[model samples]
Target: MSSQLLSEDFAENIVTTARTATGDSLRSVTYFTRSDFDQLYLRDDLEQDADLNTFVGHEWRGYRETQNAYQESELGQCKFTVRSFENGYLLRVAEDRRGVLITTDGLSMQSYEEIAEALKRMLQDADDEEA
Candidate 1:
Protein backbone atom coordinates (compact mmCIF):
# COMPACT_ATOMS: atom_id res chain seq x y z
CA MET A 1 0.00 0.00 0.00
CA SER A 2 1.21 3.47 -0.88
CA SER A 3 -0.01 6.99 -1.53
CA GLN A 4 0.39 9.25 -4.48
CA LEU A 5 -0.97 12.68 -5.23
CA LEU A 6 -2.59 12.94 -8.60
CA SER A 7 -2.52 16.05 -10.75
CA GLU A 8 -5.88 17.79 -10.91
CA ASP A 9 -6.23 17.05 -14.58
CA PHE A 10 -5.54 13.36 -14.11
CA ALA A 11 -7.79 13.23 -11.13
CA GLU A 12 -10.61 14.69 -13.16
CA ASN A 13 -10.17 12.05 -15.84
CA ILE A 14 -10.23 9.32 -13.23
CA VAL A 15 -13.44 10.62 -11.71
CA THR A 16 -15.02 11.00 -15.11
CA THR A 17 -14.03 7.53 -16.21
CA ALA A 18 -15.37 6.01 -13.01
CA ARG A 19 -18.65 7.88 -13.26
CA THR A 20 -19.13 6.91 -16.89
CA ALA A 21 -18.20 3.31 -16.30
CA THR A 22 -20.35 2.79 -13.25
CA GLY A 23 -23.37 4.72 -14.52
CA ASP A 24 -23.33 6.35 -11.12
CA SER A 25 -25.17 9.58 -10.71
CA LEU A 26 -22.95 12.61 -10.19
CA ARG A 27 -24.19 13.09 -6.64
CA SER A 28 -23.62 9.45 -5.70
CA VAL A 29 -20.04 9.49 -6.83
CA THR A 30 -18.22 10.72 -3.80
CA TYR A 31 -14.54 11.49 -4.02
CA PHE A 32 -12.41 10.47 -1.07
CA THR A 33 -10.75 13.32 0.72
CA ARG A 34 -7.65 13.09 2.87
CA SER A 35 -9.72 13.15 6.03
CA ASP A 36 -12.05 10.52 4.71
CA PHE A 37 -9.20 8.15 4.01
CA ASP A 38 -7.40 9.13 7.18
CA GLN A 39 -10.31 8.03 9.27
CA LEU A 40 -10.32 4.58 7.63
CA TYR A 41 -13.98 4.34 8.36
CA LEU A 42 -16.78 3.93 5.91
CA ARG A 43 -19.12 6.84 5.64
CA ASP A 44 -22.38 6.46 7.51
CA ASP A 45 -24.24 7.29 4.35
CA LEU A 46 -22.54 4.41 2.60
CA GLU A 47 -22.85 2.15 5.61
CA GLN A 48 -26.52 2.87 6.02
CA ASP A 49 -27.41 1.49 2.63
CA ALA A 50 -28.90 -1.96 3.17
CA ASP A 51 -27.56 -3.24 -0.12
CA LEU A 52 -24.00 -2.25 0.68
CA ASN A 53 -23.90 -3.16 4.36
CA THR A 54 -24.06 -6.84 3.63
CA PHE A 55 -20.40 -6.73 2.65
CA VAL A 56 -19.34 -4.28 5.35
CA GLY A 57 -17.72 -5.83 8.39
CA HIS A 58 -14.47 -6.84 10.05
CA GLU A 59 -13.13 -7.92 6.70
CA TRP A 60 -12.46 -4.26 5.99
CA ARG A 61 -10.36 -3.90 9.11
CA GLY A 62 -7.11 -5.00 7.53
CA TYR A 63 -7.64 -2.91 4.44
CA ARG A 64 -8.44 0.07 6.59
CA GLU A 65 -5.25 -0.23 8.57
CA THR A 66 -3.09 -0.79 5.52
CA GLN A 67 -4.61 2.09 3.60
CA ASN A 68 -4.59 4.50 6.51
CA ALA A 69 -1.02 3.75 7.46
CA TYR A 70 0.18 4.04 3.91
CA GLN A 71 -1.57 7.35 3.45
CA GLU A 72 -0.09 8.79 6.59
CA SER A 73 3.46 7.52 6.27
CA GLU A 74 4.12 7.16 2.59
CA LEU A 75 3.95 9.97 0.10
CA GLY A 76 4.13 9.31 -3.63
CA GLN A 77 4.26 5.63 -2.89
CA CYS A 78 2.39 3.01 -4.90
CA LYS A 79 1.88 -0.72 -5.02
CA PHE A 80 2.72 -2.40 -8.28
CA THR A 81 0.50 -5.40 -8.71
CA VAL A 82 -0.57 -7.40 -11.73
CA ARG A 83 -4.27 -7.18 -12.33
CA SER A 84 -6.07 -10.23 -13.71
CA PHE A 85 -5.79 -9.05 -17.32
CA GLU A 86 -2.18 -8.24 -16.62
CA ASN A 87 -2.35 -5.36 -19.03
CA GLY A 88 -2.15 -2.19 -16.97
CA TYR A 89 -1.32 -0.46 -13.72
CA LEU A 90 -4.00 -1.16 -11.15
CA LEU A 91 -4.87 1.50 -8.61
CA ARG A 92 -6.84 -0.84 -6.40
CA VAL A 93 -8.61 0.45 -3.31
CA ALA A 94 -10.40 -2.59 -1.90
CA GLU A 95 -11.62 -5.93 -3.14
CA ASP A 96 -14.03 -8.64 -2.02
CA ARG A 97 -16.64 -11.03 -3.33
CA ARG A 98 -19.13 -8.21 -3.66
CA GLY A 99 -16.96 -5.69 -5.57
CA VAL A 100 -13.81 -3.67 -5.87
CA LEU A 101 -12.85 -0.06 -5.17
CA ILE A 102 -10.16 1.60 -7.20
CA THR A 103 -8.96 4.77 -8.88
CA THR A 104 -6.17 6.96 -10.14
CA ASP A 105 -7.92 9.54 -8.05
CA GLY A 106 -9.87 8.61 -4.91
CA LEU A 107 -13.02 7.27 -6.51
CA SER A 108 -14.46 3.91 -5.51
CA MET A 109 -15.98 1.35 -7.85
CA GLN A 110 -18.15 -1.70 -7.46
CA SER A 111 -17.43 -2.96 -10.94
CA TYR A 112 -14.27 -4.87 -11.68
CA GLU A 113 -14.54 -4.24 -15.40
CA GLU A 114 -14.76 -0.53 -14.78
CA ILE A 115 -11.80 -0.63 -12.46
CA ALA A 116 -9.69 -2.52 -14.98
CA GLU A 117 -10.59 -0.26 -17.87
CA ALA A 118 -10.01 2.95 -15.95
CA LEU A 119 -6.67 1.64 -14.78
CA LYS A 120 -5.73 0.52 -18.26
CA ARG A 121 -6.51 3.94 -19.65
CA MET A 122 -4.65 5.73 -16.91
CA LEU A 123 -1.59 3.53 -17.33
CA GLN A 124 -1.67 3.82 -21.11
CA ASP A 125 -1.75 7.57 -20.89
CA ALA A 126 1.14 7.57 -18.50
CA ASP A 127 3.11 5.29 -20.78
CA ASP A 128 2.40 7.46 -23.80
CA GLU A 129 3.61 10.49 -21.94
CA GLU A 130 6.78 8.74 -20.87
CA ALA A 131 7.55 7.70 -24.42
Candidate 2:
Protein backbone atom coordinates (compact mmCIF):
# COMPACT_ATOMS: atom_id res chain seq x y z
CA MET A 1 0.00 0.00 0.00
CA SER A 2 1.16 3.52 -0.76
CA SER A 3 2.29 5.35 2.32
CA GLN A 4 0.12 8.36 1.56
CA LEU A 5 -2.95 6.21 1.07
CA LEU A 6 -2.42 4.75 4.51
CA SER A 7 -2.49 8.15 6.08
CA GLU A 8 -5.20 9.17 8.49
CA ASP A 9 -6.39 11.68 5.90
CA PHE A 10 -7.41 8.90 3.56
CA ALA A 11 -9.29 7.01 6.22
CA GLU A 12 -11.05 10.15 7.35
CA ASN A 13 -11.99 10.97 3.78
CA ILE A 14 -13.73 7.64 3.29
CA VAL A 15 -15.53 7.96 6.59
CA THR A 16 -16.68 11.47 5.75
CA THR A 17 -17.82 10.42 2.31
CA ALA A 18 -19.78 7.49 3.70
CA ARG A 19 -21.58 9.79 6.08
CA THR A 20 -22.57 12.12 3.29
CA ALA A 21 -24.93 9.50 1.94
CA THR A 22 -25.69 7.59 5.12
CA GLY A 23 -26.40 10.55 7.38
CA ASP A 24 -27.63 9.35 10.76
CA SER A 25 -28.99 6.10 9.42
CA LEU A 26 -25.69 4.25 9.38
CA ARG A 27 -25.81 2.03 12.44
CA SER A 28 -22.97 -0.45 12.21
CA VAL A 29 -20.76 -2.68 10.14
CA THR A 30 -21.26 -6.42 10.67
CA TYR A 31 -18.20 -8.25 9.48
CA PHE A 32 -18.39 -11.78 8.19
CA THR A 33 -16.81 -14.49 6.17
CA ARG A 34 -18.69 -17.25 4.32
CA SER A 35 -19.07 -19.39 7.43
CA ASP A 36 -20.38 -16.91 10.02
CA PHE A 37 -20.34 -13.51 11.63
CA ASP A 38 -16.87 -12.29 12.54
CA GLN A 39 -16.56 -8.69 13.73
CA LEU A 40 -18.48 -5.45 13.74
CA TYR A 41 -17.93 -1.65 13.50
CA LEU A 42 -20.33 0.69 15.19
CA ARG A 43 -20.87 4.42 14.88
CA ASP A 44 -20.68 4.68 18.61
CA ASP A 45 -19.60 2.54 21.51
CA LEU A 46 -22.54 0.49 22.68
CA GLU A 47 -23.80 -2.98 23.42
CA GLN A 48 -23.89 -5.39 20.54
CA ASP A 49 -27.19 -6.83 19.42
CA ALA A 50 -27.44 -10.52 18.64
CA ASP A 51 -30.61 -10.12 16.60
CA LEU A 52 -28.95 -7.62 14.28
CA ASN A 53 -26.31 -10.16 13.38
CA THR A 54 -29.08 -12.67 12.67
CA PHE A 55 -30.73 -10.21 10.31
CA VAL A 56 -27.47 -9.61 8.47
CA GLY A 57 -27.01 -13.34 8.04
CA HIS A 58 -30.35 -13.66 6.32
CA GLU A 59 -29.63 -10.65 4.17
CA TRP A 60 -26.27 -12.00 3.12
CA ARG A 61 -27.89 -15.25 2.03
CA GLY A 62 -30.43 -13.35 -0.01
CA TYR A 63 -27.60 -11.39 -1.59
CA ARG A 64 -25.85 -14.58 -2.62
CA GLU A 65 -28.96 -15.64 -4.48
CA THR A 66 -29.18 -12.31 -6.31
CA GLN A 67 -25.50 -11.81 -6.90
CA ASN A 68 -25.96 -11.81 -10.65
CA ALA A 69 -27.81 -8.53 -10.57
CA TYR A 70 -24.78 -6.51 -9.50
CA GLN A 71 -22.16 -8.69 -11.17
CA GLU A 72 -21.91 -6.60 -14.31
CA SER A 73 -21.75 -3.25 -12.62
CA GLU A 74 -18.62 -1.41 -11.46
CA LEU A 75 -19.22 -2.49 -7.89
CA GLY A 76 -19.17 -6.13 -9.00
CA GLN A 77 -15.41 -6.24 -9.37
CA CYS A 78 -15.02 -6.32 -5.62
CA LYS A 79 -18.31 -8.09 -5.01
CA PHE A 80 -19.63 -4.76 -3.83
CA THR A 81 -23.38 -4.43 -3.53
CA VAL A 82 -26.11 -2.95 -1.40
CA ARG A 83 -29.32 -4.39 0.04
CA SER A 84 -32.14 -2.28 1.43
CA PHE A 85 -34.27 -3.38 4.33
CA GLU A 86 -37.07 -1.65 6.25
CA ASN A 87 -34.68 0.67 8.08
CA GLY A 88 -31.36 0.79 6.24
CA TYR A 89 -29.04 -0.83 3.73
CA LEU A 90 -26.16 -3.31 3.67
CA LEU A 91 -22.98 -2.72 1.71
CA ARG A 92 -21.45 -6.09 0.91
CA VAL A 93 -17.73 -6.09 0.17
CA ALA A 94 -15.35 -8.89 -0.85
CA GLU A 95 -18.13 -11.44 -0.87
CA ASP A 96 -15.79 -14.21 -2.00
CA ARG A 97 -13.44 -13.54 0.89
CA ARG A 98 -14.02 -11.23 3.79
CA GLY A 99 -17.51 -9.76 3.62
CA VAL A 100 -18.85 -6.63 5.23
CA LEU A 101 -22.32 -5.94 6.62
CA ILE A 102 -22.90 -2.20 6.61
CA THR A 103 -26.17 -1.32 8.32
CA THR A 104 -28.09 1.91 8.40
CA ASP A 105 -31.42 3.02 9.81
CA GLY A 106 -33.99 5.81 9.29
CA LEU A 107 -32.68 6.55 5.82
CA SER A 108 -34.92 7.28 2.86
CA MET A 109 -34.77 5.31 -0.37
CA GLN A 110 -32.85 8.15 -1.95
CA SER A 111 -30.32 8.03 0.84
CA TYR A 112 -29.92 4.34 0.34
CA GLU A 113 -29.18 4.93 -3.31
CA GLU A 114 -26.78 7.67 -2.40
CA ILE A 115 -24.95 5.38 -0.04
CA ALA A 116 -24.76 2.69 -2.68
CA GLU A 117 -22.99 5.09 -5.00
CA ALA A 118 -20.70 6.42 -2.33
CA LEU A 119 -19.93 2.92 -1.15
CA LYS A 120 -18.41 1.87 -4.45
CA ARG A 121 -16.03 4.77 -4.44
CA MET A 122 -15.19 4.24 -0.80
CA LEU A 123 -14.32 0.62 -1.44
CA GLN A 124 -12.18 1.56 -4.38
CA ASP A 125 -10.36 4.19 -2.39
CA ALA A 126 -10.05 1.78 0.49
CA ASP A 127 -8.53 -0.81 -1.80
CA ASP A 128 -5.91 1.77 -2.67
CA GLU A 129 -5.00 1.67 0.96
CA GLU A 130 -4.28 -2.02 0.66
CA ALA A 131 -2.36 -1.72 -2.55
Candidate 3:
Protein backbone atom coordinates (compact mmCIF):
# COMPACT_ATOMS: atom_id res chain seq x y z
CA MET A 1 0.00 0.00 0.00
CA SER A 2 1.34 3.46 -0.92
CA SER A 3 -0.98 5.29 1.45
CA GLN A 4 0.17 8.40 3.25
CA LEU A 5 -3.03 10.30 4.07
CA LEU A 6 -5.64 7.53 4.05
CA SER A 7 -5.90 4.76 6.62
CA GLU A 8 -5.81 1.19 5.38
CA ASP A 9 -9.30 0.49 6.67
CA PHE A 10 -10.73 3.64 5.15
CA ALA A 11 -9.10 2.93 1.82
CA GLU A 12 -10.46 -0.61 1.85
CA ASN A 13 -13.87 0.68 2.77
CA ILE A 14 -13.77 3.01 -0.19
CA VAL A 15 -12.93 0.12 -2.45
CA THR A 16 -15.67 -1.98 -0.88
CA THR A 17 -18.26 0.70 -1.43
CA ALA A 18 -17.24 0.97 -5.06
CA ARG A 19 -17.21 -2.78 -5.53
CA THR A 20 -20.60 -3.22 -3.94
CA ALA A 21 -22.11 -0.52 -6.06
CA THR A 22 -20.44 -1.56 -9.30
CA GLY A 23 -20.42 -5.33 -8.65
CA ASP A 24 -18.25 -7.72 -10.68
CA SER A 25 -17.82 -5.15 -13.39
CA LEU A 26 -15.60 -3.06 -11.18
CA ARG A 27 -12.08 -3.39 -12.50
CA SER A 28 -9.92 -1.43 -10.06
CA VAL A 29 -10.05 0.98 -7.14
CA THR A 30 -7.25 3.42 -6.33
CA TYR A 31 -7.04 5.93 -3.50
CA PHE A 32 -4.82 8.91 -4.19
CA THR A 33 -3.64 12.02 -2.48
CA ARG A 34 -1.96 14.96 -4.17
CA SER A 35 1.43 13.26 -4.06
CA ASP A 36 0.90 9.56 -3.42
CA PHE A 37 -1.51 6.77 -4.28
CA ASP A 38 -2.49 3.26 -3.20
CA GLN A 39 -4.03 0.56 -5.26
CA LEU A 40 -6.74 -0.77 -3.02
CA TYR A 41 -8.15 -3.28 -5.46
CA LEU A 42 -7.49 -4.64 -8.95
CA ARG A 43 -9.17 -7.47 -10.80
CA ASP A 44 -7.09 -10.64 -11.06
CA ASP A 45 -7.00 -10.66 -14.83
CA LEU A 46 -5.21 -7.33 -15.13
CA GLU A 47 -1.50 -6.70 -15.16
CA GLN A 48 -0.23 -5.50 -11.80
CA ASP A 49 3.12 -4.15 -12.99
CA ALA A 50 1.79 -1.30 -15.06
CA ASP A 51 3.40 2.13 -14.52
CA LEU A 52 1.08 3.64 -11.97
CA ASN A 53 3.42 6.50 -11.15
CA THR A 54 2.83 8.05 -14.55
CA PHE A 55 -0.88 7.49 -14.31
CA VAL A 56 -1.04 8.98 -10.83
CA GLY A 57 0.84 12.05 -11.99
CA HIS A 58 -1.64 12.56 -14.77
CA GLU A 59 -4.60 12.08 -12.45
CA TRP A 60 -3.24 14.52 -9.89
CA ARG A 61 -2.88 17.18 -12.52
CA GLY A 62 -6.36 16.40 -13.81
CA TYR A 63 -7.81 16.75 -10.33
CA ARG A 64 -6.20 20.14 -9.87
CA GLU A 65 -7.31 21.39 -13.25
CA THR A 66 -10.87 20.20 -12.71
CA GLN A 67 -11.32 22.49 -9.73
CA ASN A 68 -11.59 25.54 -11.94
CA ALA A 69 -12.39 23.81 -15.19
CA TYR A 70 -15.82 25.34 -15.66
CA GLN A 71 -15.83 28.45 -13.49
CA GLU A 72 -17.34 30.52 -16.30
CA SER A 73 -20.13 28.07 -17.00
CA GLU A 74 -23.43 27.43 -15.25
CA LEU A 75 -22.79 23.73 -14.79
CA GLY A 76 -21.21 24.39 -11.36
CA GLN A 77 -18.20 22.63 -9.87
CA CYS A 78 -17.32 19.29 -11.26
CA LYS A 79 -18.83 16.48 -9.27
CA PHE A 80 -16.74 13.89 -11.04
CA THR A 81 -15.21 12.94 -14.38
CA VAL A 82 -15.80 9.87 -16.49
CA ARG A 83 -13.50 8.74 -19.28
CA SER A 84 -14.70 6.06 -21.64
CA PHE A 85 -12.39 3.51 -23.16
CA GLU A 86 -13.04 0.89 -25.73
CA ASN A 87 -13.33 -1.78 -23.04
CA GLY A 88 -14.48 0.07 -19.91
CA TYR A 89 -14.97 3.37 -18.12
CA LEU A 90 -12.86 5.33 -15.69
CA LEU A 91 -14.60 7.39 -13.03
CA ARG A 92 -12.79 9.94 -10.89
CA VAL A 93 -14.07 11.84 -7.85
CA ALA A 94 -12.00 14.27 -5.87
CA GLU A 95 -12.40 16.37 -2.74
CA ASP A 96 -9.72 18.77 -1.65
CA ARG A 97 -6.41 17.02 -2.21
CA ARG A 98 -7.63 13.45 -2.18
CA GLY A 99 -9.62 11.30 -4.55
CA VAL A 100 -10.57 7.84 -5.74
CA LEU A 101 -10.09 6.51 -9.26
CA ILE A 102 -12.52 3.79 -10.22
CA THR A 103 -12.45 1.70 -13.39
CA THR A 104 -15.32 -0.52 -14.39
CA ASP A 105 -16.78 -2.40 -17.31
CA GLY A 106 -19.67 -0.86 -19.20
CA LEU A 107 -22.49 0.16 -16.87
CA SER A 108 -25.65 2.22 -17.12
CA MET A 109 -25.48 6.00 -16.74
CA GLN A 110 -27.50 5.69 -13.54
CA SER A 111 -24.89 3.40 -12.02
CA TYR A 112 -22.15 5.94 -12.70
CA GLU A 113 -24.09 8.77 -11.12
CA GLU A 114 -24.98 6.70 -8.05
CA ILE A 115 -21.39 5.69 -7.45
CA ALA A 116 -20.04 9.17 -8.15
CA GLU A 117 -22.43 10.78 -5.69
CA ALA A 118 -21.61 8.25 -3.00
CA LEU A 119 -17.87 8.70 -3.55
CA LYS A 120 -18.10 12.47 -3.53
CA ARG A 121 -19.82 12.34 -0.16
CA MET A 122 -17.27 9.94 1.23
CA LEU A 123 -14.35 12.02 -0.03
CA GLN A 124 -15.89 15.13 1.41
CA ASP A 125 -16.33 13.39 4.74
CA ALA A 126 -12.72 12.38 4.71
CA ASP A 127 -11.62 15.88 3.88
CA ASP A 128 -13.72 17.22 6.71
CA GLU A 129 -12.07 14.83 9.13
CA GLU A 130 -8.67 16.10 8.06
CA ALA A 131 -9.70 19.69 8.63
Tens digit per residue, CA lDDT, model 2, 1-131: 11222345544554565566676766775545455664434667445655865766676676676675665787544335566677556666543433455676666666655655665555555556667
Top-down lDDT ranking = 3, 2, 1
My TM-score estimates for the predictions, one after another, are 0.34, 0.51, 0.92
Off by over 4 Å in 2: 1-16, 35-40, 43-47, 51-53, 68-95, 124-131
Q: What residue runs in model 1 are displaced by over 4 Å at the alpha carbon?
A: 1-4, 25-44, 47-111
Query: By lDDT, who's the top model here?
Result: 3
- The better-scoring model by TM-score among 1 and 3 is 3
Estimate every model's Cα lDDT from 0 to 1.
0.39, 0.57, 0.85
The model with the greater TM-score, 1 or 2, is 2
| Minimal lDDT window, size 10, model 3 | 1-10
Better of 1 and 3 by lDDT: 3
Minimal lDDT window, size 10, model 2: 1-10
TM-score of 1: 0.34
CA RMSD for every model? 12.5, 6.4, 1.6
